[model samples]
Every structure is written in C-alpha cells, then in structure tokens.
Target: RVIPAQAALFAHVWLDPQNPPRAIMLQYYRDGWMHRAVWGDYDVIPWGAANTTERVHQGELPALGEWTRLEVPVEQLGLNTGDALTGFALTQFGGHVAWDQVSIRGTSDPANDPLRSFAAWWRSVAGKDTPGLSGELADLAKRGPQAEASVEARRRLLNHYLINVCADTQRSLAQPKAELARLQAERTALEASIPSTFVYRDLDQPRDAFVMLRGAYDKPGEGVQPAVPAVLPPLTATGANGRATRLDLARWLVAPEHPLTARVTVNRFWQQVFGTGLVKTSYDFGSQGEMPSHPELLDWLAIEFQRSGWDVKQLMRLLVTSNAFQQTSQVSPELLARDPENRWYARGPRLRLDAEQIRDNALFVSGLINLTMGGKGVKPYQPENIWEPVGFAGSNTRFYTQDHGDALYRRSIYTFIKRTAPAPFLSNFDAPNREQFCTRRERSNTPLQALQLMNDVQHVEAARELAARMLREGGDSAESRIAWAYRLLLTREPAAEELAIVQAQLTAHTNRYAADLAAAQQLIGNGESKPDATLPADTLASYTLVANMLLNLDETLTRN
Candidate 1:
C-alpha cells in the first residue's frame, strides 16, 4: 500500500570497532516478488571517506562510536509511476554496519495504492460486479496532470474516496471512532460471507491415456481408456456415464470377490500395530512379494475385517486385544533358531518406535507433552545454523527458530518437516523425505541415534524435566525413586537387577556432580522449562544422568 512517489530512505548507523567499508542497497518489490529488474540496486553508496558534498556528507567520519544519518531520494533512484510500491529494503554488505531507526517516507498517491477507494465506491454504487468500475478507475489514474481540472469530476472522485476510504473529516487526521467501529462490523460481515466449501470440476470428455514405448517420454503408443491392470480384478461401472473410471477401479479393488483386496488391507494394518506385516512386503502382494507367514490367520483376520464393513478402528482393537498379541517378547533359543524374525507370532511385538513416536514418547513420559492435536506444524528445538550449512533457504526453514513454551514440546508429528532439511534426529532415525508414498520405513542402528537420545536438545530437556519430577515426587530413597521412574516411563516396574544397576549409576553420578557444581547446574537447567529451584543442583543432575541412561535403553526406545 506504500506510495513511493518522491519517497526517501533514511537510517542511522554506527561503526566503531567495525569493518571500514559498507554499502547499502535500496531494493523494491512489485507486489511482493523481488527479481533482478526490481532490485533497484546502487541506490545509496555510503562509505568512510575524508570529504564533503551538498547531498552527501563526508568529513573524516568519527573514529569513536557515533551515529550518522544516510538518506536516498526516490527521484535519484529509478522508480516508476506504475511501480505499485510494496516496501523498502536496506541491505548492508561488507564487514559490519549496525543499523537503528530506519524509515521510508513520501506523500501519498492514490494511483499506487492497493485499496482503490474509487473502485470500491463504484462497485457499491453499481450494486454488482462490473468491468466499468475497474476500467474507469484505471482511466482516472492516467489523468495525472489533468486530475484537478474538472470540478464535477473532482467531486465524484472525492465522494467515492469518502465512502470507500476514510471520511475526509477536517477535525482529525486519524479515523473517527464511529467509522472505525463500522469498519470492524463490515470486516466481520465480509469474512462471514466468504463461503467455506470446495468444488471440483471434471472435463466433459475425459482425456485418453497412452503408454510410452520402453517408458520413453518422446515415444507414443495407441490411446487407451481408463483401466485396471489385467492381472488384478476387473473394474465395474461406477461413474455416471457407465465407462469404468479411476473411481471404479478403487471400488473394484475392495469388491468382495477380489482375492488380494481384504488380505492386503488387513496385512498393512497388522504391520502398523505388530512391527511387521503378515505378508512382509506390504507394498507388493503379487507372486513376486514374500508369502504370508501365517496364511490361515491372515485369511481369518481379512474375513473378519471385511465382515465388519471395513471398520479400521474395530479391526485394530480386535488385533491388539487378542491373546496372541499379549505374549511376552522374550524368546527361547530354540524359537529364535526356528524363526529369527518371529514371523510365526511366537512373541509379542518388540521394535524401536517410529521416528515421530520416539520424540512423542519422550515428551509423554516427561509430562512436557503438548497434547493439543492437529494444527499447523511447529518448529521445535534444532541445532543453530543447521539449515544454513546445507543451503536450505526455504521460507519456513531459512532460520530454524525453536518454538517457545508448550509449542516447543508438541508431538514430533507436528515438528516443521522441511523436505530439503528434515529434523536432524528424526532424519537420523530413518524418517522419510516424503517425496512419494511411504510404504515402509527401514530402521537403522547407528551412533547418531544413540547420541540423539542422550544429547539432543529436546531429549536432554525431557531427561532434565523427568529427573526434576523424580526428585520432587519420587520416594525419598534413591532405589525407590529409580523404581518409580522405571514404572512411569515403561508402564511396568523394573526387575531387581535393573533397579540395582540404575541405583549404582545414580550413586556414581551424584559423586560426579558433587565434584563440579557448575557442570551440574548447566545439566539441571538445559531448556525453557524452569528448573525446580527447590531441588539442589547435585540432586537433579545426578538423577538427570540416571534418566539419560534410562531413555537411551533399548526398552525405552522400543515398543514391546
């Protein structure tokens, strides 16, 4: 909405123990997009020199810390009358030029403004959308020199201005209170009038499909109609015109007669809850894919799933609540030798949590979880300049600013996922780049995963907060507190041997923290969550060490 007509850029800058030379460029954007032509480069060339001029000031600039005003006039720069000016940009390049109190000023020009009052009032007077309202408004702006000539013409434009913009009240420059209130009402009504629905359109004649020779882009083949593969179920008529469509293909895939339909559906859901799909290769169910480990069990589950009208939640509930799912994960040597991957359902599901769940679990156990479900993705704690080093300069991830307060602790699913630069810990743990459908996520064991669990900022913060809770809420003795932590984190009490091991680690860490109070203080207060001021640094630090070990354990990272 800025009118840069006769406008000027001004800024106060100070350079003391700083770089000797710096240049400021005045860049302009049409609307908001900036390009080579609109950059308006070489607008202001200020430097430290021993001289003086009328428009330029220079006299052996003060060596001590001192502020100097730099200005650039719009006339001197190449500014177009048609340039619907967006904003001013001041960029300093050289060693360093610290700036303060920057501004751009100019007399208003209605032609360059975004909100055309004349256009708005014309539309209101016309009582409907019309081409003349816009065409006449454009004609008025072009009457630059002749604008103030005709009295009647001036009055018409003035009336339009008053009705659409602000009333030209001489009493005050600011908008009157009553008019402001009316503005709020109008805005509310306008917002409410906007329909909240979506419409999709289809072509009257659907486009024909063709196969490329050897999948070559340039080679063309005979046109084909919408179809399913010959090897799969034959498609049925679903579209209005009765020709089989992609939608028809979808319907045919789920038809009861299709042999692979229900079986594949149940197998994918089983994989989600039980670590491995029954077919092993969920993406491929043809002869090329792995055969089902328990074919009869797969068939029975598929039949039940289909009978329930494809009730996904009910199927999942039934699967998890079954007797077979609750068995202990531990395996005897003979069973391990017979079925290495436990394909025969010999044991309960036991595998590392998915990338998202790993972070969610840490937040959940620490009581720092933001349970708010489904919203815009949030930026969580990430290493500084992590994106910069990799040339990730997208709008969302140019500079990773960690969200504050509860947002900083939201579920990992809400973490701002940039395709170019995924969250480090999640990416390290094999989270996908998401360019295509993620049929499977391969799990990897690496030093990065271990390091992240022990030292990533969020994980460290979770450990500290969890340790604080353990110290304040857990029983007095170290053994009792360790046992309490185990139950809270894992939903089960630790064995006697596990308790003894953690207890020993706590005693060793206590001595280590007691020897260095400063190191202990840093560990106890690692994140935004305020540390328990009541607990001694040594106590929290000792427990943080034990908590760190507990979080890094295979049992904590895996779901069993």
Candidate 2:
C-alpha cells in the first residue's frame, strides 16, 4: 500500500497454533532509505544500518488459531503520506499464518459511525465527484442497518453505488480503451499484411520417445528411436544430427520404393470419383481391412500415379476417361443380382451427389452461383432459431443472421458451418457434423432430402430463377419450354411420354394459378431474386412448379 498521512494499516490475521510466528515485520521506504518495523518477541539485527526499529507487542498477538485485528499506525513505522510500503512479512522464522482484508485508512471511528467513514473512504479513493453517488450513499445511511429488510435495502444501495463507481471508472478509462483497441487493430492489420507460412523446424536436441504401457502416459515401458513400421521399408534418410526429421519422413512417404503411401493416396482419389475405394476401408489399410477387389489394378494405378509425379489433374483425367468409368450404370437384373455393389467393375459409378454438390448444382443450373474464389464463409438462409437450442448464450453463433445479395449466392464451399447446428438443408442430406476426421461420408436416402429439395428457400428460389430462364430463353411455346427445361436440367431431350407428362402438369398448374392470382404471386415470390416483370405471374408460377419437379428428379440428383 502507498502510505497516507495519519493513516493506519488494518489486517485480520489467523496464526497457526502449532507454529505461531516469533515476530512480524513491516518494511517500508522513507526519504529513499529502508526502515524495518518489528513486532512480537524476537531478536532485531541492525544489519549494519541504524534504520531498524523494534516494538514489543507480545500482548497484542492474537490467541493462537483465533482471528484478531492488527493495527499499525504510519507514524509508528516512520512513514508519511506518499511513502511506498515495500513489503509485509509474517513469521519470518517459518510459520503458517493467513492474512485477510488488509487495508490502509485514516484514523476514523468506523465501529461507531461506519457510514461517514465509508463516505470518507470513497472520497479518498475516488478523488472526484460521481453522479448518483451522493444520493445512493444518503439512501443507504438512512436505512441504518437494523432490521433484515433494512439491511437488504442498505446492501442493495451499496451495490448500486459500487456499480456507479465502476461505471464512472470505465468512463474515465474511455480514451485509453479506444487507444488500446486502435493499437490491437493496427497489430492485426500488420500481421495480415505480412505473408507467412508454416514450416517445420527441428529442435537443437531431439526429444526421446518411449512406448507407453497400456497407452498410459505415465507408464512408459521402453525407449524407442525414430523409424518406420517394421513391416514396410525402413527410413534411410537422416538429418545432419544423424536423426530422422520431418523432412526425411516426408521424402520417405513419396519415395517410389514405399508401398503404402502412393497406394493410399491413389485410393482416396479413386474413392472420390468411384463412390468406393478399391480396398473398401479407405482410412484403414491394415490386416483387418478388406482385401483389394483388384490387387493388380491397384498396384498398376499406384505406380502410374507416382510415375505422373503425383499430378492430381492428370490422374483425374485418366480415371474419368477410362472405358470402365464411362460404362453405363444401367445393368440387367441378372448382372445386378450377381454384383449389387459393382465391386467387380461391372458398371459405371451411380450414386447421389454429396450435400455440397447438390446445393451447388441447383445454383449453377439457375445461374445464381457466385464463382468468387476466396473469402470468409457466407451465411445463407436456414430455418429460424435452429441454432438457439444447441448454442451457448455467450457464443457468437447463438443467433443465425442470413446474408443478403451476393453473399446469399456464393458457392456451397464458402457456406459458413456451425458445428452445433449445421445448416438444416445440408444436414438433412447426410452432411457430417464435422466433429471428427471423415475419410468417407455416409450417404442415406430419406424423405427429408426430397422435402429439402422441394421446399427450402434456396432451392425454391433456384427453381423460380430457373423458370425465368426457361421462359425467356426457351422457344415461345409451352411444348418448346418443357423440352428446353428438360434439356437444361437433365442434359438430354425429354422422351415423348416424359414431355407429355410435364406439359400436362404445367397446363393444370396454369389453370389453377389463373383462377387464384394471389397464389400465383406468392409462388413467384419465393426467393430474394426479383421476378422478371415482363413474364406473367401465372405463367411463371406454373413453370416454377414444373422446374421444382425437374430439380427433384432422381436423375438430376445422381451421378451415373
């Protein structure tokens, strides 16, 4: 504490009965000289200076194990206002003692008149007039601290006064706070302006590793050295320190002699295109994993991948351009019965698109997808309050605010993902929760997936936009419009039967909407995109239903 003139130090201290302190010492600096004040029965050493002062207070020491008040005046310790109190030491001879509520205050009779003492202390500390403080103090003083209700009221007034004091302190600190915020923003900008990347750096001395017993960290069984698995090729590369480094491990992974790395890498890419890996268990390549369906083909592809210098684009081109990949997915019932999963390369890949692919496909066909390359994630429309149940009150994601304009139309890759409550449109299509690493996503067909495609605002808007495109670019006839939409969505001319079915539905919708113009307006206003003013509302709404039907078709959702 800083010394105050005519003030005394007060403390409540408890001394251990088994080991009471032999003495207590208060050391302070006065006029650039050190002085020590000793209490209790103990020897006082001059320490080659005349500044040492001793006071015998054996009678004042509290009874052992009982809390007692200890007071020392500044004058007795040769201290004046503004002098620095350097240190306070208890039981210098090694004893356990606890100190509490230590404070320095002027000599005021707090026991008899605490309200005035409290006001004085506030004035001394605050050093300025605070708004509402005087009224709160007066209200508290009037309560008198008597009955339980009065005590509660007085406590509330004190709390309110303290809150005001804190608010005043905050106001006083506003300039510094703004300066700190500006400095932090400047630091962040400086960091972002500098180009940086992470690189591995070896420590001067390698840390020793040990195998744990039963995987318990504390139960280390045996020391081990850096090496690859014994079943595969040994690690031959080493750093200048004659130890294997991360660089050496990296070189070993891509080395032609290594058997597993190239195979695993090729398998993962193959799985991305084929919907299943050759080994079935893409993440696990162990003894318990399924054997490769075509071992020779796997080896040949692995070698070819390594030979291409691991060019992913070249590998994708080779895979997609192969005869096996281009085969028709349709098969005879006998062939399907023999190989339901197509593990024998019996047919081309036929599977539903992933969640991101499904969303992006709709936007792409509707000409609403923003192809902007890099930025932070964007928020699109989702059901209201979906995140509230799973979100913490203090979390930034407690409220989901949908974005507008271009942000609403960015690619699905740039969609902001909240782990607790993922976008319902994506989750309903079996998107992973992202809580752990996923080598392969599980695909499931459910009614919710179809419902999302049919009713979601994004999809509905996409359909409306698609309908606008069909009306404007399609020939000026209903049959021509239906054929144009089928080609745009399915990438093929619709069969006569399929064309007739859609035309009939469009006619029925047009009749139904023509009778109810409000229904037509509501249907055309499903999305943020403005409807084309030139097109009739009933016509657009009729075509919107047709477009939604095409978007939800199995052929549109699957890659065959």
Candidate 3:
C-alpha cells in the first residue's frame, strides 16, 4: 500500500480471536516514515484492538484497523504447516480508511505450497465442469501404482511437502563460533584456487570470427570481420583506427549518416501515438520488413529524437496530447473508405485498454488506487493458482513488500516484472512476451478475453467495491448514486437516456433485493457490508452479471 506521507502508525496481529492468521509472523515490508502496517479480524477483542507483544513505532498511535504493511515471522506466531492467513481487515478506527492491494506469502518458499498448486489446477480446467464427474484427479483410481498414478502421487507429495516445509518448523544448520570462523577460513582458501577472471589470451590481433564447421573450435571457415551490411554504405575504419568493438558498432548505428536510425525512431513515435507507425515495422529496417508509408516523416522524428537528447518523456507527451492522438475514434464511412487502417492518423486509434491500464484505470477511478511510485516489484493480485510451475521452469515468485496501498497502485510500468508468469490481465491484453524482441504487439480479440471480463474474480470484486463506494459517497438519493457511478465509470455526467437506463436498472435491482439488503450490498465484493438481511445467492450473482454486461459494452472497453 502506497500511503500518503502522513503521520500514522500501523500494526498487525497473527493470532486474533475471530480470524487469527494461520501464520505467526506478518513480515511487513514497510519502511518507517509516513507508512506503517496494520492488521484486522480480531473479533474477540475490540474492533480496533489486538493482543500482541510486538513493539509499535514510538510517538504515534497505531493505525490498527487501517491496511498497512508489517512483517511477522512464523516462529513468533506458532502456526505450523497446513495453516494459512485467509484475510486482513483494514480499519481507520474513526479515521479515513483507505486500503489497496493485499496478499500473503511465507517467509521461505511459499510459492510451492499445495493450496496454491490446487488453485492453479482449478484455473487450468477451462469451461464448466461436468455436474457429477471430477476432473483429471478423480479419473484416477483411489488405489493404484500405475505410471500415471506415480506422477499424480509425485505431485501430491510435492504439494504436501511444500505446505509442510513452509508451515512446519524444522532443525536448521548452525555452527559454534570458533568452528564457524575456521570453516569460513577454509572456504576462503578453497575459493582462492580459481582466478578472478578466466584464463584466456586477449585477441590483441585483429581477427574476425569464422563460421565454425560442426560448431567445433578447430573447424573455422572463411573469416567475416565486423562490418556494415553490404546493402548499407561500407564502414570507414576511422573511429576505432581499423579495430572493431561494440562502441564502434553503437556509434555507427546512431550516426546521422546512418539511414535507418532516424527513420526507425520517428516511426516508433508515430506508432506509440496512433497505434501504428509509418513503417509498421518500427525496429526492423531489413528488406523483409514493411516499407515506411511516410518515409520523410519517419526520418524527421528520428532526427528530432537525437536532437532532443533522446528525451522519451518529452516525445511521448507531445504525441499523446496532440490533436491527432486525441481525435475521437468515431468511425466515419467516408474516412474509412479513404483510409480504413487510419494510416495517415486522420483519426485517433480506438484501442481497448491494455491489461495493466485496464486494471489500473478501474482501481484508480474507483478511489481505491494508491499512487506510490517506484520500488522493488510488488505482486499484483493474481488468482491463487496461477503461480505454479508447470513442469520444467522454477517458480518465478518475486513480489514487492509495499509500505502502503499507494505503492500497489503505482503505474504498471514500475510493477515488478518476472520472466515467467507475467500478470495474466496484462498478458491477455497483448502485453509483449518478455522472451523475445517485442517491436510491436499483436492486437487480438478472443472469447477468452470476454470470459475474463465477465467472470474473472478481480474485476467482479472491483465492480462491487466501486459500486458500494458510489453509494457511500453519493447522497441518499438513487439519482446521486447513478450520477456517481457515471462519473466514476465514464469520467463524465450521464446523458439523459443514460440516466434513465441506470435508474431503471437500479430500481429493478433494489426492488428485487428489497428483502435482502445484504444481498444487494454483496453485489459489490469488497467485503464491506451494510446492515441488512442477506440476499439470495442468485440475486448477488445477478448484480455481478449486470456489472459484467457493463464491462463488456464497447464504450466501456474502448478508448475514444
């Protein structure tokens, strides 16, 4: 959580009366300043109180109920294997309550745990399951020693060990002070056997690498020294005085004399603003790549980038805020006939929000976003199962330890990136696969995406939370609630027809769930509840269904 730089204290308790976390220590990743860590779900104690011997920061009252970052170790909490921290409740205790991204992990190898493994398996089974039949595991006989059984047993054991190792304590290796010192000296002596640098001769003489026959060291073919491509002008040996090095290569690529540099830069800028560059192949200037539609313009921008000291922010700002970029994406038949792809930037790009932007925008407008900037990578909320390693690769489970909610809502650019398991929402919206050179991304439309918008748990929760916030922030009138929803979702006042539709929708839902205020409130899944009877499970599901409809509308998904 990226908290405001305000004077506040935060605290956490692993063991509480009503909802004690399965783990003992809450290892808080907070820095001591404006931020602090807080905990919740202590039903036995007063709403804002808990029993714990942990030290609180001095001169400040703890932000007991408010969501804040804190650290607790398992040894202190007394929870062993098979336990888990289900949730944390943030309370302001009669103060402003703001909470954002929250997640839990073990002090050690938490990613390998069984519950998470099960969750991943559940996610992989796409579509509805058969009403009575179990999936893969159910198909296997209860008692068997077949090859498939062996694999399944291995998986079960691995998951079991993960949970046990994380939750259970075990004897750790330790050494006496004198013996430890002796071992350190011995290890140092062993390390001294290897040289700091590799034993090799510098290629002092000018030599070019030959194509190795059979990839064997002794089987060198015709030499091909470093030089500019034949299609481009020949390289002059002046810069390195006839020697070749990476510096010389970089200089050649960036030199104004080079034909592709300026052209590539400008085209990329155009693509960034209008969704398609002049050349369409921004990085590739090879013969196989597309030719620039506006060659002159491409050269112009490239030159400009160099002249501006490669100021990326300056270039982006100019492009995004321009009339060309901002033009309404209302399709005109005549314009479409003239330029269907909008190659000339006659109209702005009408693109669906990229994954991170989609999540960020929803969270931001709903008033839940914390805007802390830059730090170690924090884990974006993910479905519990998605972190599992399928077969070969190790788990890529690096996550951030945020001090406050603001850090969680910082722009996705600063989000921690892992080579394996990039956030799903971002990937769904065509985030570049990190494995390759991603000069451009494929804009794909698929049913999987539609399903995600309709049913992904996170979006459903956001919708409910935002809806509740609209109700709370708006006045008592339904009109006020409708207005607030419009402002939050569309960032503008609702049109008269739009207001009428919203009124009808809200009224219908209100009446339908009149007997169950809890049901109506549950429509927003933030877990905050209003005092009322619970609605039928189906009624709450209806609210989500309606929210999904809203999310799927062309207007909601598209940028104008």
Best-fitting candidate, scored by lDDT = 2
The runs of at least 3 residues in candidate 2 whose Cα sits more than 4 Å from the true structure, single-residue gaps closed, are 1-185, 192-201
Model 1 has an lDDT value of 0.73
- The lDDT, on a scale of 0 to 1, for candidate 2 is 0.79
Better of 1 and 3 by TM-score: 1
lDDT of 1 by residue, 1-560 (tens): 34345776566767545564434443555554231111112334432121222123222333436777766564444444334455655555454556677666676555434344454333333333323335555455445424444666656656545554643442453557568889999999998988678655556787766888899878879877777678776788766677676666777877887888899889988998888898999999987999988899999998898899999999999988987788888999999999889888889988888889988888888889999999888988888777766564466457767789889988887888777778887889988886667878889999989988888878888998889888878888888788889888887898989888888888899999999999999987788988888889998999988888888888888878
Task: Please give the ranking of all candidate structures by TM-score, highest first, separated by commas.
Answer: 2, 1, 3
Please give the TM-score that candidate 2 achieves against the real structure: 0.66
Winning candidate number (TM-score): 2
**CA lDDT, every model vs. true structure:** 0.73, 0.79, 0.56
Q: Which residue runs of candidate 3 sit more than 4 Å off their true CA positions? A: 1-208, 212-219, 230-241, 391-410, 415-420, 472-476, 517-552
| Candidate 3 per-residue lDDT over residues 381-480, each given as its tens digit | 5555544553245433533232334554556776665566677777888998687878776778999888887666556665654554554576677677
**TM-score, predicted candidate 1 vs. hidden true structure:** 0.64
* Candidate 2, 512-534: lDDT as tens digits: 99999999999889878899989
Prediction 3 global C-alpha lDDT: 0.56
